[model samples]
Target: MQDAILDVKNLSIRYNGASEDAVRGVSFTLGRERLGIVGESGSGKSTVGRALLRLLPGARVTADRLRFEDVDLLDLSEREMLKVRGRRMSMILQDPKFSLNPIQRVGAQVAETYLRHFPANKAEARAKTLEMLAAVRIRDPERVHDLYPHEISGGMGQRVMIAMMLLADPDLVIADEPTSALDVTVRLQVLNILDGLVRDRGIGLIMISHDLNLVRNFCDRVLIMYAGRVVETLDARDMDAAEHPYTRGLLAAQPRIGGTRGPLAVLDRRPEWKEGSTP
Candidate 1:
Protein backbone atom coordinates (compact mmCIF):
# COMPACT_ATOMS: atom_id res chain seq x y z
CA MET A 1 0.00 0.00 0.00
CA GLN A 2 1.11 3.54 -0.65
CA ASP A 3 2.07 5.62 2.37
CA ALA A 4 -0.80 7.97 3.15
CA ILE A 5 0.22 11.63 3.23
CA LEU A 6 -3.28 12.89 3.97
CA ASP A 7 -6.31 10.98 5.24
CA VAL A 8 -9.73 12.61 5.39
CA LYS A 9 -12.57 10.44 6.59
CA ASN A 10 -16.29 11.19 6.62
CA LEU A 11 -15.61 14.89 6.27
CA SER A 12 -18.55 17.25 6.19
CA ILE A 13 -18.94 21.03 6.17
CA ARG A 14 -22.02 23.19 6.87
CA TYR A 15 -22.35 26.92 6.53
CA ASN A 16 -24.34 28.88 9.10
CA GLY A 17 -28.12 28.53 8.53
CA ALA A 18 -27.60 26.25 5.52
CA SER A 19 -30.22 23.58 5.12
CA GLU A 20 -27.61 20.87 4.75
CA ASP A 21 -23.87 20.39 4.65
CA ALA A 22 -21.92 21.89 1.78
CA VAL A 23 -19.77 18.77 1.80
CA ARG A 24 -21.50 15.57 2.82
CA GLY A 25 -19.69 12.50 4.11
CA VAL A 26 -16.60 12.89 1.95
CA SER A 27 -13.66 10.57 2.53
CA PHE A 28 -10.42 10.22 0.65
CA THR A 29 -6.73 9.54 1.00
CA LEU A 30 -3.73 11.06 -0.69
CA GLY A 31 -0.27 9.61 -1.04
CA ARG A 32 2.76 11.45 -2.40
CA GLU A 33 0.90 11.71 -5.69
CA ARG A 34 -1.32 14.05 -7.67
CA LEU A 35 -5.11 13.74 -7.20
CA GLY A 36 -7.77 15.66 -9.08
CA ILE A 37 -11.28 16.65 -8.07
CA VAL A 38 -13.65 17.54 -10.93
CA GLY A 39 -17.20 18.89 -10.80
CA GLU A 40 -19.53 21.64 -11.89
CA SER A 41 -20.17 24.84 -9.93
CA GLY A 42 -21.44 24.62 -6.32
CA SER A 43 -20.28 21.01 -6.17
CA GLY A 44 -18.29 21.48 -2.93
CA LYS A 45 -14.98 20.58 -4.58
CA SER A 46 -13.45 23.92 -3.58
CA THR A 47 -14.99 23.71 -0.14
CA VAL A 48 -13.24 20.39 0.47
CA GLY A 49 -9.93 21.85 -0.61
CA ARG A 50 -10.32 24.97 1.60
CA ALA A 51 -11.46 22.95 4.60
CA LEU A 52 -8.22 20.99 4.61
CA LEU A 53 -6.32 24.26 5.11
CA ARG A 54 -8.76 25.40 7.82
CA LEU A 55 -9.43 28.45 5.66
CA LEU A 56 -13.15 28.61 6.38
CA PRO A 57 -13.93 29.64 9.93
CA GLY A 58 -17.62 30.33 9.50
CA ALA A 59 -18.19 26.96 7.86
CA ARG A 60 -18.31 24.08 10.32
CA VAL A 61 -16.10 21.16 9.32
CA THR A 62 -16.26 17.80 11.05
CA ALA A 63 -14.71 14.46 10.33
CA ASP A 64 -14.04 11.14 11.88
CA ARG A 65 -10.46 11.78 10.92
CA LEU A 66 -8.62 14.63 9.20
CA ARG A 67 -4.92 13.99 9.50
CA PHE A 68 -1.94 15.33 7.64
CA GLU A 69 1.42 13.70 8.17
CA ASP A 70 -0.19 11.78 11.03
CA VAL A 71 -1.16 14.95 12.92
CA ASP A 72 -4.79 15.84 13.61
CA LEU A 73 -5.51 19.12 11.84
CA LEU A 74 -8.65 19.84 13.87
CA ASP A 75 -6.76 19.91 17.13
CA LEU A 76 -4.12 22.47 16.22
CA SER A 77 -4.28 25.96 17.69
CA GLU A 78 -4.04 28.97 15.37
CA ARG A 79 -0.39 29.59 16.31
CA GLU A 80 0.48 25.95 15.68
CA MET A 81 -1.40 26.01 12.41
CA LEU A 82 0.61 29.00 11.22
CA LYS A 83 3.77 26.94 11.55
CA VAL A 84 2.35 24.19 9.35
CA ARG A 85 0.56 26.29 6.74
CA GLY A 86 2.72 27.49 3.81
CA ARG A 87 5.60 25.46 5.23
CA ARG A 88 4.38 21.87 4.97
CA MET A 89 1.02 22.55 3.29
CA SER A 90 -0.10 25.40 1.00
CA MET A 91 -2.89 26.47 -1.36
CA ILE A 92 -3.01 28.43 -4.63
CA LEU A 93 -6.10 30.54 -5.08
CA GLN A 94 -8.10 30.56 -8.35
CA ASP A 95 -7.33 34.15 -9.29
CA PRO A 96 -4.00 35.86 -8.87
CA LYS A 97 -5.50 39.36 -8.86
CA PHE A 98 -7.42 38.69 -5.66
CA SER A 99 -4.82 36.37 -4.15
CA LEU A 100 -1.98 38.90 -4.45
CA ASN A 101 -1.80 42.31 -2.82
CA PRO A 102 -2.22 45.02 -5.45
CA ILE A 103 0.15 47.50 -3.76
CA GLN A 104 3.09 45.27 -2.78
CA ARG A 105 6.02 44.87 -5.12
CA VAL A 106 6.02 41.27 -6.39
CA GLY A 107 9.55 40.51 -5.28
CA ALA A 108 9.19 41.95 -1.78
CA GLN A 109 6.00 40.04 -1.12
CA VAL A 110 7.60 36.78 -2.19
CA ALA A 111 10.74 37.54 -0.22
CA GLU A 112 8.65 38.20 2.86
CA THR A 113 6.93 34.87 2.44
CA TYR A 114 10.28 33.15 2.29
CA LEU A 115 11.60 34.97 5.33
CA ARG A 116 8.53 34.14 7.35
CA HIS A 117 9.35 30.43 7.27
CA PHE A 118 13.10 30.57 6.77
CA PRO A 119 15.61 32.20 9.10
CA ALA A 120 17.37 34.16 6.37
CA ASN A 121 18.89 37.59 5.93
CA LYS A 122 17.25 40.12 3.59
CA ALA A 123 19.83 39.45 0.88
CA GLU A 124 19.31 35.69 1.23
CA ALA A 125 15.57 36.09 0.99
CA ARG A 126 15.86 38.27 -2.10
CA ALA A 127 18.20 35.76 -3.73
CA LYS A 128 15.82 32.89 -3.01
CA THR A 129 12.87 34.81 -4.41
CA LEU A 130 14.72 35.58 -7.63
CA GLU A 131 15.74 31.95 -7.97
CA MET A 132 12.14 30.84 -7.54
CA LEU A 133 11.03 33.37 -10.13
CA ALA A 134 13.50 31.91 -12.59
CA ALA A 135 12.47 28.41 -11.63
CA VAL A 136 8.93 29.31 -12.68
CA ARG A 137 10.39 30.35 -16.06
CA ILE A 138 9.84 34.07 -15.57
CA ARG A 139 12.28 36.26 -17.53
CA ASP A 140 13.75 39.46 -16.09
CA PRO A 141 13.19 38.41 -12.50
CA GLU A 142 14.80 41.63 -11.20
CA ARG A 143 12.47 43.98 -13.09
CA VAL A 144 9.41 41.81 -12.47
CA HIS A 145 10.21 41.86 -8.78
CA ASP A 146 9.89 45.63 -8.63
CA LEU A 147 6.60 45.72 -10.52
CA TYR A 148 3.23 45.77 -8.81
CA PRO A 149 0.52 43.17 -9.63
CA HIS A 150 -1.10 45.41 -12.24
CA GLU A 151 2.12 45.77 -14.23
CA ILE A 152 2.27 42.09 -15.15
CA SER A 153 0.12 39.97 -17.44
CA GLY A 154 -2.40 37.56 -15.91
CA GLY A 155 -0.13 34.60 -16.66
CA MET A 156 2.90 36.28 -15.11
CA GLY A 157 0.90 37.27 -12.04
CA GLN A 158 -0.07 33.62 -11.62
CA ARG A 159 3.54 32.54 -11.86
CA VAL A 160 4.39 35.10 -9.18
CA MET A 161 1.70 33.68 -6.92
CA ILE A 162 3.08 30.20 -7.49
CA ALA A 163 6.60 31.44 -6.66
CA MET A 164 5.37 32.80 -3.34
CA MET A 165 3.60 29.57 -2.42
CA LEU A 166 6.70 27.51 -3.13
CA LEU A 167 8.87 29.89 -1.07
CA ALA A 168 8.07 27.91 2.05
CA ASP A 169 8.94 24.58 0.35
CA PRO A 170 5.63 22.97 1.17
CA ASP A 171 5.31 19.20 0.75
CA LEU A 172 1.64 19.43 -0.21
CA VAL A 173 -0.02 21.96 -2.52
CA ILE A 174 -3.73 22.37 -3.11
CA ALA A 175 -4.18 24.26 -6.38
CA ASP A 176 -7.76 25.41 -6.92
CA GLU A 177 -8.40 26.12 -10.61
CA PRO A 178 -4.85 27.36 -11.03
CA THR A 179 -5.25 27.94 -14.77
CA SER A 180 -8.90 28.92 -15.07
CA ALA A 181 -8.12 32.49 -16.09
CA LEU A 182 -5.49 31.78 -18.72
CA ASP A 183 -6.05 31.44 -22.45
CA VAL A 184 -5.89 27.91 -23.89
CA THR A 185 -2.23 28.06 -24.90
CA VAL A 186 -1.20 29.77 -21.69
CA ARG A 187 -3.23 27.30 -19.66
CA LEU A 188 -1.19 24.42 -21.04
CA GLN A 189 2.01 26.31 -20.22
CA VAL A 190 0.89 26.85 -16.63
CA LEU A 191 -0.04 23.19 -16.30
CA ASN A 192 3.39 22.22 -17.59
CA ILE A 193 5.03 24.29 -14.86
CA LEU A 194 2.83 22.67 -12.22
CA ASP A 195 3.60 19.22 -13.63
CA GLY A 196 7.30 19.95 -13.33
CA LEU A 197 6.92 21.09 -9.72
CA VAL A 198 5.16 17.86 -8.73
CA ARG A 199 7.54 15.55 -10.59
CA ASP A 200 10.77 17.29 -9.56
CA ARG A 201 9.87 18.07 -5.95
CA GLY A 202 7.77 14.99 -5.13
CA ILE A 203 5.09 17.30 -3.74
CA GLY A 204 1.65 15.80 -3.16
CA LEU A 205 -1.01 17.77 -5.06
CA ILE A 206 -4.79 18.10 -4.83
CA MET A 207 -5.89 19.89 -8.00
CA ILE A 208 -9.46 21.11 -7.78
CA SER A 209 -11.02 22.00 -11.12
CA HIS A 210 -14.22 22.01 -13.18
CA ASP A 211 -12.49 20.96 -16.40
CA LEU A 212 -12.69 17.21 -16.84
CA ASN A 213 -10.42 17.14 -19.89
CA LEU A 214 -7.73 19.16 -18.16
CA VAL A 215 -7.79 17.00 -15.05
CA ARG A 216 -7.79 13.80 -17.11
CA ASN A 217 -4.64 14.87 -18.91
CA PHE A 218 -2.84 16.54 -16.01
CA CYS A 219 -3.59 14.36 -13.00
CA ASP A 220 -2.92 10.75 -11.98
CA ARG A 221 -6.29 10.08 -10.34
CA VAL A 222 -9.70 11.75 -10.65
CA LEU A 223 -12.71 12.11 -8.37
CA ILE A 224 -15.98 13.16 -9.97
CA MET A 225 -18.41 15.12 -7.81
CA TYR A 226 -22.03 16.28 -8.10
CA ALA A 227 -24.18 18.28 -5.71
CA GLY A 228 -21.60 18.18 -2.87
CA ARG A 229 -21.00 14.43 -3.15
CA VAL A 230 -18.36 12.39 -4.91
CA VAL A 231 -20.13 10.02 -7.27
CA GLU A 232 -17.18 8.37 -8.91
CA THR A 233 -13.44 7.96 -8.58
CA LEU A 234 -11.12 6.46 -11.16
CA ASP A 235 -7.68 6.43 -12.68
CA ALA A 236 -7.18 9.56 -14.73
CA ARG A 237 -5.92 7.57 -17.69
CA ASP A 238 -9.00 5.38 -17.53
CA MET A 239 -11.61 8.12 -17.10
CA ASP A 240 -13.01 7.02 -20.46
CA ALA A 241 -14.03 3.79 -18.73
CA ALA A 242 -16.01 5.54 -15.99
CA GLU A 243 -19.23 3.68 -15.04
CA HIS A 244 -21.50 6.26 -13.41
CA PRO A 245 -24.29 7.95 -15.37
CA TYR A 246 -23.19 11.39 -14.23
CA THR A 247 -19.62 10.72 -15.27
CA ARG A 248 -20.75 9.44 -18.65
CA GLY A 249 -22.95 12.50 -19.14
CA LEU A 250 -20.00 14.81 -18.57
CA LEU A 251 -17.94 12.95 -21.13
CA ALA A 252 -20.72 13.06 -23.70
CA ALA A 253 -21.24 16.82 -23.34
CA GLN A 254 -17.77 17.62 -24.68
CA PRO A 255 -17.75 18.72 -28.32
CA ARG A 256 -15.47 16.64 -30.52
CA ILE A 257 -13.36 18.48 -33.05
CA GLY A 258 -13.58 16.42 -36.23
CA GLY A 259 -17.18 15.19 -36.22
CA THR A 260 -20.69 16.18 -35.19
CA ARG A 261 -22.71 14.24 -32.62
CA GLY A 262 -26.13 13.28 -34.01
CA PRO A 263 -28.15 14.41 -30.99
CA LEU A 264 -25.59 16.07 -28.73
CA ALA A 265 -26.96 14.03 -25.86
CA VAL A 266 -28.40 16.10 -23.03
CA LEU A 267 -27.52 15.16 -19.46
CA ASP A 268 -30.39 13.56 -17.59
CA ARG A 269 -31.10 16.14 -14.89
CA ARG A 270 -34.07 14.31 -13.44
CA PRO A 271 -31.83 12.21 -11.17
CA GLU A 272 -30.79 15.34 -9.34
CA TRP A 273 -34.34 16.31 -8.43
CA LYS A 274 -35.39 15.30 -4.93
CA GLU A 275 -38.80 14.97 -3.28
CA GLY A 276 -39.33 18.63 -2.37
CA SER A 277 -36.59 20.23 -4.47
CA THR A 278 -37.50 22.00 -7.75
CA PRO A 279 -34.08 22.09 -9.38
Candidate 2:
Protein backbone atom coordinates (compact mmCIF):
# COMPACT_ATOMS: atom_id res chain seq x y z
CA MET A 1 0.00 0.00 0.00
CA GLN A 2 2.90 2.36 -0.60
CA ASP A 3 0.92 4.49 -3.01
CA ALA A 4 -2.57 3.55 -1.99
CA ILE A 5 -5.46 5.46 -3.54
CA LEU A 6 -8.16 4.16 -1.19
CA ASP A 7 -7.99 3.05 2.45
CA VAL A 8 -10.86 1.86 4.61
CA LYS A 9 -10.46 0.50 8.12
CA ASN A 10 -13.26 -1.04 10.15
CA LEU A 11 -15.95 0.23 7.83
CA SER A 12 -19.56 -0.60 8.76
CA ILE A 13 -22.96 0.45 7.45
CA ARG A 14 -26.65 0.16 8.42
CA TYR A 15 -29.86 1.25 6.79
CA ASN A 16 -32.24 3.88 8.18
CA GLY A 17 -34.27 1.32 10.13
CA ALA A 18 -32.29 -1.88 9.91
CA SER A 19 -32.36 -4.16 12.92
CA GLU A 20 -28.61 -4.69 12.67
CA ASP A 21 -25.63 -3.54 10.65
CA ALA A 22 -25.86 -4.62 7.03
CA VAL A 23 -22.10 -4.29 6.59
CA ARG A 24 -19.64 -4.44 9.47
CA GLY A 25 -15.89 -4.43 9.97
CA VAL A 26 -15.06 -4.56 6.28
CA SER A 27 -11.61 -3.11 5.57
CA PHE A 28 -9.09 -3.09 2.76
CA THR A 29 -6.46 -0.91 1.11
CA LEU A 30 -6.21 -0.51 -2.64
CA GLY A 31 -3.17 0.49 -4.69
CA ARG A 32 -2.76 0.67 -8.46
CA GLU A 33 -4.12 -2.85 -8.83
CA ARG A 34 -7.38 -4.67 -9.57
CA LEU A 35 -9.07 -5.82 -6.37
CA GLY A 36 -12.23 -7.93 -6.50
CA ILE A 37 -15.07 -8.05 -4.01
CA VAL A 38 -17.14 -11.22 -4.43
CA GLY A 39 -20.28 -12.27 -2.59
CA GLU A 40 -23.84 -13.40 -3.12
CA SER A 41 -26.63 -10.87 -3.50
CA GLY A 42 -27.42 -8.89 -0.30
CA SER A 43 -23.93 -9.49 1.04
CA GLY A 44 -23.23 -5.73 0.92
CA LYS A 45 -20.79 -5.79 -1.97
CA SER A 46 -22.62 -2.93 -3.70
CA THR A 47 -23.24 -1.13 -0.43
CA VAL A 48 -19.52 -0.76 0.33
CA GLY A 49 -18.82 0.70 -3.11
CA ARG A 50 -21.71 3.17 -2.74
CA ALA A 51 -20.57 4.14 0.76
CA LEU A 52 -17.17 5.26 -0.50
CA LEU A 53 -18.81 7.84 -2.76
CA ARG A 54 -21.45 8.80 -0.17
CA LEU A 55 -24.15 7.49 -2.54
CA LEU A 56 -26.12 5.71 0.18
CA PRO A 57 -28.52 8.39 1.29
CA GLY A 58 -30.15 7.40 4.53
CA ALA A 59 -27.65 4.73 5.55
CA ARG A 60 -25.52 5.07 8.67
CA VAL A 61 -21.87 4.64 7.70
CA THR A 62 -19.00 4.59 10.16
CA ALA A 63 -15.36 3.90 9.48
CA ASP A 64 -12.24 4.35 11.52
CA ARG A 65 -10.40 5.32 8.34
CA LEU A 66 -12.02 6.13 5.01
CA ARG A 67 -9.56 8.08 2.92
CA PHE A 68 -9.52 8.51 -0.83
CA GLU A 69 -5.95 9.50 -1.64
CA ASP A 70 -5.31 12.39 0.81
CA VAL A 71 -8.91 13.57 1.30
CA ASP A 72 -11.11 12.27 4.10
CA LEU A 73 -14.39 11.06 2.58
CA LEU A 74 -16.43 11.42 5.80
CA ASP A 75 -15.48 15.06 6.11
CA LEU A 76 -16.40 16.15 2.58
CA SER A 77 -19.63 18.06 2.00
CA GLU A 78 -21.98 17.05 -0.84
CA ARG A 79 -20.77 19.97 -2.95
CA GLU A 80 -17.11 19.22 -2.16
CA MET A 81 -17.59 15.51 -2.95
CA LEU A 82 -18.97 16.46 -6.37
CA LYS A 83 -15.52 17.73 -7.35
CA VAL A 84 -14.07 14.34 -6.45
CA ARG A 85 -16.70 12.28 -8.26
CA GLY A 86 -16.48 11.97 -12.08
CA ARG A 87 -13.09 13.74 -11.84
CA ARG A 88 -10.84 12.00 -9.33
CA MET A 89 -13.11 8.98 -8.74
CA SER A 90 -15.92 7.27 -10.64
CA MET A 91 -18.25 4.29 -10.39
CA ILE A 92 -19.21 2.28 -13.47
CA LEU A 93 -22.68 1.06 -12.59
CA GLN A 94 -23.96 -2.43 -13.56
CA ASP A 95 -26.77 -1.57 -15.97
CA PRO A 96 -26.71 1.03 -18.70
CA LYS A 97 -30.47 0.67 -19.31
CA PHE A 98 -31.12 2.49 -16.04
CA SER A 99 -27.86 4.38 -15.71
CA LEU A 100 -27.84 6.12 -19.09
CA ASN A 101 -30.17 8.94 -20.09
CA PRO A 102 -32.72 7.38 -22.43
CA ILE A 103 -33.51 10.60 -24.23
CA GLN A 104 -29.98 11.77 -25.08
CA ARG A 105 -27.59 10.37 -27.62
CA VAL A 106 -24.73 8.36 -26.10
CA GLY A 107 -22.08 10.74 -27.39
CA ALA A 108 -23.67 13.83 -25.88
CA GLN A 109 -23.92 12.14 -22.49
CA VAL A 110 -20.25 11.27 -22.58
CA ALA A 111 -19.23 14.67 -23.91
CA GLU A 112 -21.28 16.36 -21.23
CA THR A 113 -19.37 14.38 -18.59
CA TYR A 114 -16.10 15.59 -20.07
CA LEU A 115 -17.36 19.19 -20.22
CA ARG A 116 -18.40 19.06 -16.59
CA HIS A 117 -14.95 17.99 -15.43
CA PHE A 118 -12.71 19.90 -17.84
CA PRO A 119 -13.14 23.43 -19.14
CA ALA A 120 -13.31 22.61 -22.82
CA ASN A 121 -15.37 23.69 -25.84
CA LYS A 122 -18.08 21.44 -27.28
CA ALA A 123 -15.87 20.50 -30.24
CA GLU A 124 -12.98 19.63 -27.95
CA ALA A 125 -15.23 17.56 -25.68
CA ARG A 126 -16.69 15.68 -28.63
CA ALA A 127 -13.19 14.85 -29.83
CA LYS A 128 -12.25 13.50 -26.40
CA THR A 129 -15.52 11.58 -26.18
CA LEU A 130 -14.92 9.87 -29.50
CA GLU A 131 -11.44 8.91 -28.37
CA MET A 132 -12.88 7.25 -25.29
CA LEU A 133 -15.50 5.36 -27.27
CA ALA A 134 -12.89 4.05 -29.68
CA ALA A 135 -10.65 3.19 -26.74
CA VAL A 136 -13.38 0.80 -25.51
CA ARG A 137 -13.35 -0.91 -28.93
CA ILE A 138 -16.56 0.44 -30.32
CA ARG A 139 -16.48 -0.33 -34.08
CA ASP A 140 -17.94 2.97 -35.29
CA PRO A 141 -17.63 5.67 -32.67
CA GLU A 142 -19.12 8.30 -34.93
CA ARG A 143 -22.14 6.21 -35.81
CA VAL A 144 -22.84 4.82 -32.36
CA HIS A 145 -22.38 8.23 -30.78
CA ASP A 146 -25.66 9.40 -32.28
CA LEU A 147 -27.70 6.39 -31.12
CA TYR A 148 -29.92 6.59 -28.05
CA PRO A 149 -29.55 4.14 -25.17
CA HIS A 150 -32.67 2.29 -26.34
CA GLU A 151 -31.20 1.84 -29.80
CA ILE A 152 -28.06 0.03 -28.66
CA SER A 153 -27.56 -3.53 -27.48
CA GLY A 154 -26.92 -4.20 -23.80
CA GLY A 155 -23.24 -4.84 -24.46
CA MET A 156 -22.93 -1.74 -26.59
CA GLY A 157 -24.67 0.36 -23.97
CA GLN A 158 -22.24 -1.02 -21.37
CA ARG A 159 -19.29 0.03 -23.49
CA VAL A 160 -20.80 3.50 -23.74
CA MET A 161 -21.07 3.56 -19.96
CA ILE A 162 -17.42 2.65 -19.67
CA ALA A 163 -16.52 5.32 -22.19
CA MET A 164 -18.39 7.95 -20.21
CA MET A 165 -16.90 7.04 -16.84
CA LEU A 166 -13.36 6.92 -18.18
CA LEU A 167 -13.56 10.23 -20.07
CA ALA A 168 -12.02 12.19 -17.18
CA ASP A 169 -9.24 9.71 -16.35
CA PRO A 170 -10.29 9.21 -12.73
CA ASP A 171 -7.71 8.07 -10.20
CA LEU A 172 -9.87 5.20 -8.92
CA VAL A 173 -12.77 3.23 -10.45
CA ILE A 174 -15.38 1.02 -8.79
CA ALA A 175 -16.95 -1.27 -11.39
CA ASP A 176 -20.06 -3.07 -10.12
CA GLU A 177 -20.63 -6.24 -12.19
CA PRO A 178 -19.60 -4.32 -15.29
CA THR A 179 -19.98 -7.29 -17.61
CA SER A 180 -23.14 -8.94 -16.34
CA ALA A 181 -25.22 -7.79 -19.29
CA LEU A 182 -22.62 -8.70 -21.92
CA ASP A 183 -22.14 -11.91 -23.82
CA VAL A 184 -19.05 -14.10 -23.29
CA THR A 185 -17.16 -12.43 -26.12
CA VAL A 186 -18.21 -8.90 -25.22
CA ARG A 187 -17.51 -9.57 -21.56
CA LEU A 188 -13.91 -10.49 -22.31
CA GLN A 189 -13.53 -7.42 -24.50
CA VAL A 190 -14.86 -5.14 -21.77
CA LEU A 191 -12.63 -6.80 -19.20
CA ASN A 192 -9.65 -6.27 -21.45
CA ILE A 193 -10.45 -2.56 -21.58
CA LEU A 194 -10.55 -2.42 -17.77
CA ASP A 195 -7.36 -4.47 -17.57
CA GLY A 196 -5.68 -2.01 -19.88
CA LEU A 197 -6.75 0.82 -17.60
CA VAL A 198 -5.03 -0.76 -14.59
CA ARG A 199 -1.86 -1.68 -16.49
CA ASP A 200 -1.42 1.37 -18.67
CA ARG A 201 -2.97 4.17 -16.62
CA GLY A 202 -1.80 2.77 -13.25
CA ILE A 203 -5.18 3.53 -11.66
CA GLY A 204 -6.70 1.63 -8.74
CA LEU A 205 -9.73 -0.54 -9.62
CA ILE A 206 -12.28 -2.25 -7.39
CA MET A 207 -14.31 -4.87 -9.27
CA ILE A 208 -17.51 -5.75 -7.43
CA SER A 209 -18.83 -9.10 -8.56
CA HIS A 210 -20.51 -12.31 -7.39
CA ASP A 211 -18.98 -14.37 -10.17
CA LEU A 212 -16.03 -15.93 -8.34
CA ASN A 213 -14.44 -17.32 -11.49
CA LEU A 214 -14.53 -13.91 -13.15
CA VAL A 215 -12.81 -12.22 -10.20
CA ARG A 216 -10.34 -15.05 -9.74
CA ASN A 217 -9.08 -14.78 -13.29
CA PHE A 218 -9.43 -11.02 -13.84
CA CYS A 219 -8.33 -9.42 -10.56
CA ASP A 220 -5.00 -9.31 -8.75
CA ARG A 221 -6.41 -9.70 -5.24
CA VAL A 222 -9.73 -11.07 -3.95
CA LEU A 223 -11.97 -10.33 -0.99
CA ILE A 224 -14.75 -12.85 -0.26
CA MET A 225 -17.73 -11.44 1.58
CA TYR A 226 -20.39 -13.40 3.49
CA ALA A 227 -23.40 -11.99 5.31
CA GLY A 228 -22.09 -8.45 4.89
CA ARG A 229 -18.59 -9.19 6.20
CA VAL A 230 -15.31 -10.10 4.58
CA VAL A 231 -14.75 -13.69 5.60
CA GLU A 232 -11.45 -14.03 3.79
CA THR A 233 -8.87 -12.19 1.72
CA LEU A 234 -6.22 -13.70 -0.53
CA ASP A 235 -4.38 -13.34 -3.79
CA ALA A 236 -6.48 -14.20 -6.82
CA ARG A 237 -4.24 -17.09 -7.76
CA ASP A 238 -4.54 -18.54 -4.29
CA MET A 239 -8.35 -18.63 -4.22
CA ASP A 240 -8.37 -22.43 -4.30
CA ALA A 241 -6.33 -22.41 -1.09
CA ALA A 242 -8.70 -20.10 0.78
CA GLU A 243 -9.06 -21.02 4.48
CA HIS A 244 -12.47 -19.70 5.40
CA PRO A 245 -15.34 -22.18 5.25
CA TYR A 246 -17.57 -19.66 3.50
CA THR A 247 -14.96 -19.16 0.81
CA ARG A 248 -14.47 -22.89 0.39
CA GLY A 249 -18.21 -23.44 0.23
CA LEU A 250 -18.49 -20.78 -2.45
CA LEU A 251 -15.79 -22.44 -4.51
CA ALA A 252 -17.38 -25.83 -4.13
CA ALA A 253 -20.65 -24.33 -5.22
CA GLN A 254 -19.35 -23.29 -8.64
CA PRO A 255 -20.48 -25.62 -11.43
CA ARG A 256 -17.69 -26.94 -13.61
CA ILE A 257 -17.91 -27.59 -17.33
CA GLY A 258 -18.91 -31.25 -17.83
CA GLY A 259 -17.63 -32.08 -14.37
CA THR A 260 -20.61 -31.89 -12.07
CA ARG A 261 -23.67 -33.88 -13.06
CA GLY A 262 -25.12 -33.63 -9.55
CA PRO A 263 -26.55 -30.68 -7.69
CA LEU A 264 -24.08 -28.03 -6.57
CA ALA A 265 -23.18 -27.93 -2.89
CA VAL A 266 -25.23 -25.58 -0.76
CA LEU A 267 -23.49 -23.17 1.63
CA ASP A 268 -24.41 -23.93 5.22
CA ARG A 269 -25.01 -20.84 7.28
CA ARG A 270 -23.14 -20.69 10.55
CA PRO A 271 -23.80 -18.20 13.33
CA GLU A 272 -20.18 -18.08 14.49
CA TRP A 273 -18.93 -17.15 11.03
CA LYS A 274 -20.81 -13.86 11.12
CA GLU A 275 -19.97 -12.89 14.70
CA GLY A 276 -16.25 -12.18 14.24
CA SER A 277 -15.16 -12.47 10.62
CA THR A 278 -12.71 -9.88 9.19
CA PRO A 279 -10.23 -9.52 6.39
Q: Report clashes for each candidate as comma-separated counts.
A: 0, 0
RMSD of 2: 1.3
TM-score of 2: 0.97
The most accurate candidate by TM-score is: 2
Tell me the whole-model lDDT of each prediction, alpha carbons only: 0.88, 0.91
TM-score of each: 0.95, 0.97
lDDT of 2: 0.91
TM for candidate 1 is 0.95
Q: Looking at candidate 2, what is the lDDT of residue 21?
A: 93
Q: Write the per-residue lDDT of candidate 1 for residues 12-72, one digit (tens) a residue.
A: 8998789988888788999888999998899899999989999998888999999999679
